[model samples]
Target: MIEEQGIIIALDGEFAEVRTQRRSACGGCVANGACGTSLIERLFGRRVTQLRALNEVRAGVGERVLVGISEAGLLSAALAVYLVPILGLVLGALVGTWMNGLLLNRSLDGSMADLPSVIGGLIGFLLALLWLRGYSAGSSKRPEHQVVILQRLH
Candidate 1:
C-alpha cells in the first residue's frame, strides 16, 4: 500500500477531499545551489496537490489523517489513466501511416518514410488530448456519498 498524510479539505458524505503537503528535496541536497529544482522552489515556493478519496472513517474537515490505497488499486487506476491515451495514440499512428502510404503517389520508400511519421504524430497527439479531456470530464461525475474504500492507514 501507498500511504501519505493529508489534511481533510472537504467532506461530502462518504467522500473526502484531502490536500497532501509538498516536500522539497532541494533544501537538504548537496547540489542545492546549482539545481534547477531549488531555483524553481525558491521562485514558486512549495506546491500542494489535493485529491479526492472515499472516506471510510468519520473524518471531518481540517482533521489530519493518514490515507492509503492498495498497490493493486493504484496500479489499476494508473493503467486506466495512461493506457487509454496510449492506445489511441498507437491506433492513430497506424491509421495515419496507412492513409499516408495510400494517398501519396510517390514510391513506398519516399512517402512511407516521410509523411507517415508526421501525420501519425499529429493524430496521436490529438487523440491523446481528447482522451485526457474525456477522462477528466468523467471524474467530476462521481456520485455524492459514494466512495471506494480500500483500507485505512494509521
Candidate 2:
C-alpha cells in the first residue's frame, strides 16, 4: 500500500478531505543547487493536493491521519491510463498501413503514406479515451480504488 499523511480539512458522510503537500525529488537530491527541478520548485513552491479519503478511522476535522491505497490497484490504474492509449495507437497505425498496402498493392512510399496512419491514430486515441472514461466510472465504486484513513495522528 502507498501511504500518505495528511490533515483532515473537511468531512462529508463517510469521506474526509485531507490536504497534503506534494513533494518533489529536488528536496533530497544532491543536485538541488544545479537541477532544473529546483528552479521549477522555486517558481511553484510546494503545492498542496486535496484528496478525499474514506473515513475508516472516524477522524474529525483538523486531525492528522494516514491514508493508503493498494499497490496492485495503483499499478492497474496506471497501466490503463498510460499503456492502453499507446498500444491502441500502435495497433491502429499498423492496421492502417497494412490496409493501405493491401488496397494499393504498393509500398508506404506513396503520396498519402501518412494520412491513413494519422486517421487511424486519432480514431484509436478517441476509442481508448472513451474506454478509459467508462472504466473509471465503473471503478470509482470499488473499494480497491479508494484511499482509506488507517490511523489518526495526535
Candidate 3:
C-alpha cells in the first residue's frame, strides 16, 4: 500500500476530504536540476492535492490521518490512464497509413494525402478519451480504486 499523511478538511457521511501537499522524489535527487518534473515544480511550485477518502476510522475535520491505497490499484489506474491512448494513436496512424497506400496510387506533394492520418489519429484519441470517461465513472465506485483513511495521526 502507498500511504501519505494528510489533514481532513471536511466530512461527508462515510467520506472525508483530505488535503495533502504533493511531494517530489526529485527533491533529493542529483538530477533534479536537469529533470523536466523538477523544472515544472520550480516554475509552478509544489501543489496541494485534495482527495476524498473512505473515513473508516471516523476521523473528523481538522484531524490528521494516514491515507492509503493499494499499490496494485495505483499501478492499474496508471496503466489504464496512460497506455490505452498511446496504443490507440499508434494503431490509428498505422491504419491511416495503410488506407492511404491503398487509396492513393502516388503520394501527392503538399496535398491532403496525410489528411486520413490526421483524421484517423483524432478519431482514435477521441474514442480513447470516451472510453476512459466511462471507465473512470465505473471505477470511481469500486472499493479497490478508493483511498481509505488507515489511521488517525497524532
Candidate that would win on lDDT: 3
Q: Candidates 2 and 3: which is better by TM-score?
A: 3
In candidate 2, what are the lDDT values of residues 107-153, reduced to their tens digit? 66667679877778878888888999998888777888887999998
Q: Which structure among the candidates has the greatest TM-score?
A: 3
TM-scores of all candidate predictions against the true structure: 0.61, 0.83, 0.86
Give lDDT: candidate 1, residue 142: 42
User: Candidate 1 has what TM-score?
Assistant: 0.61
TM-score order of candidates, top first: 3, 2, 1
Candidate 2 local Cα displacement, residue 50, angstroms: 2.1
Scanning candidate 3 in windows of ten residues, the lowest lDDT window is 105-114
Quote the positional error of residue 102 for candidate 3 in Å. 4.7
Candidate 3 clashing pairs, residues 3+ apart or interchain: none
Candidate 2 positional error at 128, Å: 0.9
- Candidate 1 Cα deviation (angstroms), residue 142: 11
Alpha-carbon deviation at 62 in model 1, angstroms: 1.3
The regions of model 2 sitting more than 4 angstroms off are 103-111
lDDT of 3 by residue, 1-154 (tens): 9998999999999999999987888979999779898888899998999999999999999999999998888888899899989877777877777777787855546778677787778778878888888988898888889999999999
lDDT of 2: 0.86
Q: Say which prediction, candidate 2 or candidate 3, comes out ahead on lDDT.
A: 3
